[model samples]
Target: MEVSMFGGLVLVMVLVVVVVPALLVGLVLWLVSRSTSDDGGAPARAARRHELLVSSVAVLAAVVCTVVLLAQPVAWPGWASAPGVLQAITPFSVALVLCVVRAVGEQTWPRPRGEVRSAPLARRTIWSLGGARLRIVLVTAAALAVALVVFGATADPTGRAFATNPVTLPDGSVVSGASGPYPGWPYGLPMLLGLALAVAATFVALGSITRRPPLHGVPARHDDAVRATSAARLLGAVQLCLGVGLGGALAVGGAAIQSRGQNLLLDELPTHGLVAVGGGVALLGIAVVVASGIAGLLAAWPRAARHAGAPAATGAPA
Candidate 1:
């Protein structure tokens, strides 16, 4: 299928902006958690089941959402269908983000000696990854919001027409064909930018997670791991962005092919596909954002939970 440059750009945006960062954050936190354990400086095998459970749930939700949205293929759907996706997965996203954040932070930060406060394995692992994850996510959201606004301003507002002209074939058969103004780069550029920002954010987030210990932990040397992860994330983000752009271009080209084959909405297909895919990308973006926010929260959760339940920390000597 031929892909227009514009459509390809959309695909690039999705990859760079949405998926890579989440994976990076997740991996970093998992590593950090594994590196540090109470019994030994190695990750506890016991936490594997719980970690898998959270990750499984998140992936399942994403898959279900993709299927549902694709299957339903909203005709005049409500304002981009984000509200629906968010409502369905917010809880799961929130939980995962929190877990990752706490886990990552605990492992990375320099903890005070003798201040080894015990925390649930799930909490530790999740929060350790969560802090950086949350920041990346917020940035992704802001970027997406800006992209949407730009797309709105530049999108083909006339939209696809329900009724179309019929094409006459040599065999004297008539087929329905729909035509509309080209979906131009103006709309696609914001998406591209959003995707770029998302990718860049992911790379930075990974760096934050792996490069140094968390804000509050015993410092351990993971410089090599940190550098490696950061580099990988950066490269991955760029690849994803390229994918987004390329993917969109292909879809559009596909639409063109289909249109040529028969009277179909070829002109509109690629752009529409990008828009739809963009929503999916946004979902991934949200996951990243949610992860980051929860991490930040996890960094604070232990103290917050304790403070809420116990007496305040006092300046006076005990």
Candidate 2:
């Protein structure tokens, strides 16, 4: 079955519009049910209230994205395709930005599971390779390198499509049937930029999450909770952004191929299967965002439960 670029765009529309709302609804309902089951007579606390507000915002964004997505494919005179992607990304992007900002003000390091006082992880934190910090950096760098290979270095040099150039048929006639695009010195630069930005964001977020207090004693349980939430939320944001950047590059690249093909009046475009690849990336990113959010919340719910019952922190006199 031959799928066109337009068809893939609509499929992405369904992903962002239909699937997002369904996921949000299911998540909200699940949280409500879990809370009710856990504490049948308890009143909602500040954390629960905050989560509901965030859910409401997410649902609102999903509805707006639905309208924009539905309008995009039809090119409803006033609705432009470019805005569809931007709109879909805005809510997620904003949420992530808030996460990072909040991280900025977080405690320099976590307290021991049982101790009350807090201090820095070390005299100078930069050289500390302990925990997930170095791992996050290495993984992010590896991911960027892979993206560069797949999207940039391998791009077709002729600037027509990725890894494609003109070919001579048996009839001795030349055709632009190359499977890739023409490349240039600056080719695929935007993809690299997008990847770099995502990597940078991931690094900063991971650094904040991995600042552990000296680890001896019962503090380990709380440390595990911190790491679980951090991994879920930070990794989710990273993957979401990475997926968007890669998917956007593929979509734009596919459009370029269609344009070149039409201009050349070719029967087939250079990048025949590009749309499917882009759609897949978009879906992966959407899945990561939803999954990570749920995981982060679940990881922290127990911590919140403990906090709800424990006495408030009070500093002892020197």
TM-score of each: 0.34, 0.48
Best by lDDT: 2
How high is the lDDT of residue 181 in model 1?
22
Q: Candidate 2 lDDT, tens digit per residue, 30-121?
A: 57645643231222232234333443444345445544544443222342222233333332343345345435533433243554445332
Error of 2 at 251 (Å): 8.0
Per TM-score, the best of the predicted structures is 2
Prediction-by-prediction clash tally: 62, 15
Candidate 1, residue 289: the lDDT equals 38
What is the Cα-based TM-score of model 1? 0.34
Model 2: lowest-lDDT 10 consecutive positions:
309-318
Residues 173-245 of candidate 1: C-alpha lDDT, one tens digit per residue: 8765432222234324434454445444444444444333222221222222222333233333333323333
**Candidate 1, residue 165: lDDT:** 41
